[model samples]
Target chain A: MEEEVVSEENVTPVDEAEGADQEVEVTEEDARLAEIAELNNRLLRVQADYDNFRRRSREEKEAAAKYRSQNVIEALLPVIDNFERALLVKPEAEEAKSLLQGMEMVYRQFQDTLKSEGVEVIETVGQPFDPHLHQAVMQVEEEGFESNQIVEELQKGYKLKDRVLRPSMVKVNA
Target chain B: MEEEVVSEENVTPVDEAEGADQEVEVTEEDARLAEIAELNNRLLRVQADYDNFRRRSREEKEAAAKYRSQNVIEALLPVIDNFERALLVKPEAEEAKSLLQGMEMVYRQFQDTLKSEGVEVIETVGQPFDPHLHQAVMQVEEEGFESNQIVEELQKGYKLKDRVLRPSMVKVNA
Candidate 1:
């Protein structure tokens, strides 16, 4: 800010010297016209810069929103590994019943976290299949389900808000 | 852009009308000074706006970088829940053996996902305890380990590129 004031002062002395000399030949209207033109040019440049800045910032904000969960997902991977280890061990003794209970609690916590962030499972079975949410893997003649209805889910599908993250793999009733 | 041009023309006509009438009463020098003052005022306002725009854009960029991982974290919570579900079920028979193996495979995939994103575990036991990476839950006297060295990790800690998301809970040798 101080530097701006200093530069302004530097410009003033030279302008005054020019004015004293030019005042003889140059009319006041001509001088005002020149000053207005210069000011208008500067104004246009600054306005252009402001517009570009606003556009770039908006793009950056969108990218940030799109990828916000990358780190947290990475951190929770080990929690999944721990769950697999506990499951593979096959809780042999009655004493280790608490181990299973603890895992269930953690699992619930994980689900709650996802739900709070608008991540949800795509409903497949018994519902009318939509290509946006479900991918048909096979067609089966199921007795109870209607035609074009999903009879079985081969792999789970997930969505983040309205956007499908992974389409549900399913078998459609013939 | 057309609106801007029209507005500029409107301003010019009014200024010219006023100048023609005031020309007899106001000296040419006074008119030049007034025009210079108006131009100076506009130039100052534009420069101030440019400064503010630059500062605002920089803050937006910082905010975007901070929240980049939020969505990915939300998406993986369900995967963690699936691991917990697989672990909770007691594998009572040989039929469940393949189920356990499938869970293990998913768990490995989760680990690989995290590793690809630069997430890593903070090593605690046998290493010198640093408050930045390890949160000491207890202190114990140990024969082999040096003072302030971690003896056991109660819960693992994780880091995402030098930034600790969760500190390791551990016991340090007194």
Candidate 2:
């Protein structure tokens, strides 16, 4: 009787083990799926980060190509000013006068080229003055103009692709 | 007999159903894990793309800022040429000479300012001919100089931060 009972308990447990192993595979599968889900989330984030990096690099290269001439252009402004002033002078000699005219033509052509390349002169004289790209050198009272109106342009301002390279010096009317 | 068989099948089927349910659950769990893994992969790729975009924008912004003034400087080359020519000329009247002198001073100051901002003049006269920054308009046979030497700089070249704005027009000697 004692042996039979022991055998019964052992056999029952063995039988139950095989059945449970076959049935409970669902829980093991669930655990594996959970692990895979976690891994998948991590991989997705890493790939996204890599994409962002590639996009950023392409944009950077384009920007490098776009603004390659800024410093040189700024340096040339004074030369333009000189040419303009030179043209304004009325030279006595025909040769000097012709030279001045030629210089003026060249200056205009140069201005046109720069305009084509996105360099622009800021018009401030006789316009409502703003501190953003115009510097006030002196203020005076004017009968017809509103306060803070630019009466005279002391110096011209310039912009390179919407960025102010230099501020225009101006006299404002109050 | 028919009732007995039906009852036996029912009794046997309970165990079978439990085992099948568990096995099916495991398969479902695996499928879920696979789905999660796929999602994670997509997420990672998208995230990487975003990161690349961000990086490119940043680089582009930097490059734009770096090369913004090239056009303006190129436009002003003729004006600079005019000033340099004026400096070479001897004025007749005292007032006229003084005015030219003042203009010269201003031009020098302007050039100095440009130098401070990274504008450089390409020195070519008396130097060996370099096609990189010098354009040979005419070649002259000379006794004192070797072949391919620059004798005179017709038009000066200017550079900003290692970029050539214009090639200098030069007289090459053979």
Top-lDDT candidate index: 2
Best by DockQ: 1
Report lDDT (CA) for all predictions.
0.65, 0.68
lDDT of candidate 1?
0.65
Candidate 2 accuracy as TM-score: 0.61
Model 2 residue A46 distance off true place after TM-score fit, in angstroms? 5.9
Judge the docking of candidate 2 as incorrect, acceptable, medium or high.
incorrect
Native-to-model Cα distance after best TM-score fit, residue B57 in candidate 2, in Å: 6.3
Question: Fraction of true contacts reproduced, model 1?
Answer: 0.25
> Which sections of candidate 1 miss by over 4 Å?
A1-28, A41-45, A48-52, A55-63, A70-106, A139-147, B1-63, B70-105
**For residues A38-68, what per-residue lDDT tens digits would candidate 1 score against the true structure?**
8778778877887887788788777667646
Evaluated at residue B160, the lDDT of candidate 2 is 79
